[model samples]
Target: MQQFYDFKINKIKNLSSEEKILRKKNLELFYLNGFPSKKDEDWKFTDLNFILGQNFTNIVNTELIPDEKPFNPINEFEHNFIYLVNGKLISKNFDHEEKDKILISNFDYKNEIILYRENTLNFLNNALAKDGFSLEISKNYKFKKPLVIYNYFSNSLKETIVNNKNLIILNENSELTLINFVDNNSKENFIINTIDDIKLKKNSSLKSIFINNSKNNAYFYKYLKNDLEKNSNLENYILSSGLKLNKFDIEVNHNAEYSSSNIFSALNLSNYEHQEIKTLINHNTPNCQSYQKIKNVLNNESKGVFQGKIFVKNIAQKTDAYQLSRALILDDKAEFNAKPELEIYADDVKCSHGSTSGSIDLESIHYLKSRGIPEKEAYQMLINGFLCEVLEKLNENNLKKFLLKKLESQIHGY
Candidate 1:
């Protein structure tokens, strides 16, 4: 860990005087705190021992850079593309004619927005990040094609720990869709941490989709802190199918009136893969709303976890919040854990939360089978219906189709 401090000091040796001072401050704060453990309330269920125990003496040195690499874009979409390979920005593509309509920045650290202060993971990202990116959508601007970011982890990574920071901003009345696609092909054990700071100005809206199809040897964790101003809205969708252990901790704040946020997560894990989705929704102002729904299908000895909390302050009257978690345990060895909480201080609020877990209903299966349907087909139909509740919320057909394809590949034989 001491070596990591030296690496940061050396990495920014060429930077401006101000950058050097700020980077060192962040690194020092992290070095003293270390990583989180089971004692931490939020990280109680998830353990970082396996990855942290490695005691990576030094950060991995990689030749891969995001601003120079060439990669193929998704064929069905006509959107801008950002490519990140091995924790570094490799390429960003915005149609030449529309380049001015968007703003893209990298490795240019900003001191104003320090996210998740005192949190070990957030500090670690800033202290050891290879590079970072910031994306902003201009005011009153709207684009049909979504912006897609592909994060690739190659199999060559050995005895390495990667960290990345991503920031996104939307001006007033601007609307856009952002997709983060993680493709991990690494065969050896690897650890990567991502920290994202997102702010939505008044009346702006953002639709975020995260698709993870990592390999079994990778350990991936992400922390996202989002702020929503007045009349702004945000929709978050997460689809996870890989990684030896993966977790996404997202905290959303309704900073002003009339803002709304909704989160939909679908996780499918087989073999020994494990994933956890933790969300914190804060209603700080009046007349705001939030909702969360999570669905998990665990196979073999796989494990899934969902922990969500909704906090309503006194001034946040008339807040409407809802949460639910449902799990389908395919094999007797599979596991699912859920903790949903609501803390309300206002008298005028509608908040509810519940979790349910069970195997395929034999009565429903028998009913379908009695109508000449095969047992396997009936089971597939049931699973599809259960998972579609979340996928159907997607507004874009292209994204919906892509997600459906991934879901089909995982749910077919279960």
Candidate 2:
């Protein structure tokens, strides 16, 4: 395993002596465990070590200086954007909103303290991460348009690994809508490890969306940790597709009364691709609500996984939680795995979980074809309606239309 990875802390620039020592210690810790395998309970369904070993021969951490490239803004809707090349912040524009209400800058690695040590990937990120962004929204301010983070990878990243960390904070009574858009077109094989910390203060609300622009050969992993305060609301919608391998580990903590959180995902996997979404929602306070709905469509030896857990503390009376996962298998070789769990110490909590997986209904396809629809079009129409239900709650018309088009492309294997 050591032969497959080459990491050097000195390769990163502008680090103090103490920072260097801390990074070295973290790198050593990551080397001790290497990449996670099926032995780890959280990663039992996706064997990351085995998968990476099969795809990459040598992965190194190197300094990146991206060449000058033109920035392409999304035309479907009006929005602000931040352009990042190879995880480095290149430019940002916030013309749609009040400039004084937003603050953006590079991640402050010098003053930030490490929060989690149990995950080896966190250790790797702490050691090798060099570039990322930190954003904060002022209190009582709301964005007039969504902000998009355009994540781009350079063509020179073949056989290389990139690690970065991001921080987002919304103060009291603030609101925001964020989009994490991946715009990679490079066919070169690479790896991306990312960690995001989100803090929502009292009375704040946030909506986050993730999606991809095109197909690529990138293996990606992201750990998102969110903290919610009193009367706060958080919602996440993931439509990421067209990657070779991807996994999202999300954790939400309801720290105060009347806070709510929701997780929704719809994925279409084709060919040999694999994708997973794992979530842990903790109801530590009374009168909190959490919901999760995951849907997947698999085709031609593709695989999908969903692991969801709800935890209610003893003091968390009147907690409400629900979880459901559904999968549609388009081929005999396709596979789907689901694991749902509940741990409640409160007697007054209302919690439930369910999972279902099956092949698409042949009767529905036949009925559509009988109405003069072509066989191919009938299958596509059925598939489109099955997966688009996840976005019914989204109120943004133009953005929703754009996402619907992307979802259709994924279903058609374009």
Candidate 3:
């Protein structure tokens, strides 16, 4: 650990003066406040002992180019694209007709990002983020297509840990759709940590979708933080699968008036795969609105978790917020855990939270069996019907069909 830390400090010496100072400050904070442990309430349910047990001090190899480049999975995708191989940007100029409407640059390092939480994984990621990127959509530029960013991971020569930072800044009245897809190679086990910091200027809107179809026995942790200004709106969707262990941290802070958000997540799991999603929606200004709905389908011995909280400040009046988490357990050994919380300091706020989880009703299954359907097909039909309620909310027909196809494929493969 000492050798790796010393090597990173020396590596930053060649950067520009402004960046060097920022990197040094972050390093200092990393040393002062180290990793977090289970004693912290936020991390009590999730285990990190396996990660802490490994040796990530040595970075033996650098992959400048991917073994093979990934093309658009769907030919109908007409949007801009960016690919990250092992968390490093593929340095290439993409020639497009609307190139002048976009700005993409290398992200500047920041020490304060590490202080957002006391989690050790966040600390390690910020301390070792070698390369990342910044993106901005010009004002009033609404594209006909969404921008898709693929973060791909390749096997490392040694045990590898890659951290990538993304800073997305939206100017006033600008709107953009983003698909953050995390893909991987099947060679070895690695740790991939990504942090996204977003700033939505006044009246700017952002819609984001997170898709993680990880392969191999790697750990995927994503920390997402965003700030919304007055009249700004954010809609976020998450689709995750295929990892030994997966976790997500979504924190959105609303300090401006009349901004709103809708956060929805749908996870499909089978086998012993365990996944969790934790989110915090903070309302500090008046006349704001926010809502969250998280649903999951667990099969075999798979496990899932959803912890969501809504916080309204004293000054926040007429804040409308709600959270609901539901799960469908398909097997006797399958398990689901949910914790929904709400904290409000104002009297005029409207807020509510609830959690519900259960398996397929035997009466429903029996009725299907009596209708001449086999038991296995009956179960599949009922499970598919249960998840379709959540999928129906997607407004984009193309995206809805793409995700529904993926959902059907996974169910059939199982």
Candidate 4:
């Protein structure tokens, strides 16, 4: 492990001048923070011992490519595909104009903002990533076709650090739908760190879908921060399927009045898989609304966590905030931890939070059996109904249908 660390340091020392500065800044931040420990309230439930203990030495170069296709099951889905193998963009599939909108080749960030990003996990991607695609949608330009960003990893001992600084500027009265899939097809241990930054102008609408299907041996760390302007609406769905260790951080800031934010997440855990989703919503202006709902299904000895909080400032009167979390435990060994919180200084605001952890209803199952339905099929139907709420919000019929099929395949195994 020490040798691997030494090798990584030596390799990074050979990077270009710009990359060197980023790397130096990141290393300093990492040394100070040291991968949010269990002592940190937000990280108390997810364990990182396995990832920290591994001998990860490689820095996946752009020259290295994946010989195998990561996604064969859902090849029929129509999408504007931006494929990444081992953190590097294949370039052939990328459109220059579209790419520029999503990625910023040069950025001049303020000192405080830079420091915040550098100390965050996103910085790991900025420092170590070989390459990744960027997508920018024009202001108020609606996308008729679904935009799909696929992150693929296919090598053992390889770390794919994808630092994506996405600037989604939506002008007034425009709308779009996006499907993002973070997938790992390799049996090898890979690490992924991703960042998605979005800013919505007045009256723009966005529907986003996130799917994480990394391999059971992989570790994924993802962050999404959004800035909502007045009268803009954003609906988000986060799906966690495969991976040994999965950690996610999401923050939504209501910068203008009359904006709305809805966050929905579903996690399915099997084997020894571990998952965590931590989120925050801040109401900085008056009359903004935010809703959060998350669900988890744990089987075998898998573990899961959901931590969510909403803060309504004193000046943010007429704010409405709600949060809910539910977990289904299939076995005695399976475990779940939930922390849903609300902090409101505005006396006139409406805010509430709730959480539940339990197993499938036996009575519901008995009723299905009494109707002569087969046990396995009946059980699957009940499970589908439980998770359908999140999928139903996709709005796009084709995308919803596709996700339902994927959910079916996933639920049957759970």
Ordered list by TM-score, greatest first: 2, 1, 3, 4
Candidate 1 lDDT, 139-233, residue by residue in tens: 88886578888887766666556777888999999998888877765577767788888999999999998877544577778888899999999
Candidate ordering by lDDT (highest first): 2, 1, 3, 4
- In terms of lDDT, the poorest run of 10 residues in model 4 is 104-113
> Clash totals for all models, in order?
5, 0, 0, 4
Model 3, residue 414: C-alpha shift (Å): 7.6
Better of 1 and 2 by lDDT: 2
TM-score per candidate: 0.90, 0.98, 0.87, 0.86
Q: Write the per-residue lDDT of candidate 2 for residues 1-414, one digit (tens) a residue.
A: 545778899989999999999899999999998888899998999999888899988889858776657767789999999888877888999999999999999888898755467589889988998788899999999989999999999999999889888899999999999999998889999999888999999999999999987899999999999999999999999999899999999999999999999898989999889999999999999999999999999999989999898999999999999999999998999999999989999999899999999988999999998999999999889889988999998999999999899889888876
Model 3: per-residue Cα lDDT over 198-232, one tens digit each: 89988998989877654446667888898999999
lDDT of 4 by residue, 1-414 (tens): 332221132344246566567666776665465556566666778645335555255434223444546454345455666655554555334332354434322222222133336334555545554444444455656666676666666554455333433435566666667777766656766566666667787888888888765445777777778889999999988776777787778889999999999988877788888888888899999999998889888889999889898989999999999899998898899999988878888888989989999999999999999999988888778877887777766666777888777666667653
- Off-target runs (Cα >4 Å) in candidate 3 are 1-35, 50-72, 91-97, 110-118
Candidate 2's TM-score reads 0.98
Candidate 1 lDDT? 0.79
lDDT of each: 0.79, 0.91, 0.73, 0.69
lDDT of 3 at 167: 87
Candidate 3 Cα deviation (angstroms), residue 30: 5.2
C-alpha-based local distance difference test score of model 3: 0.73
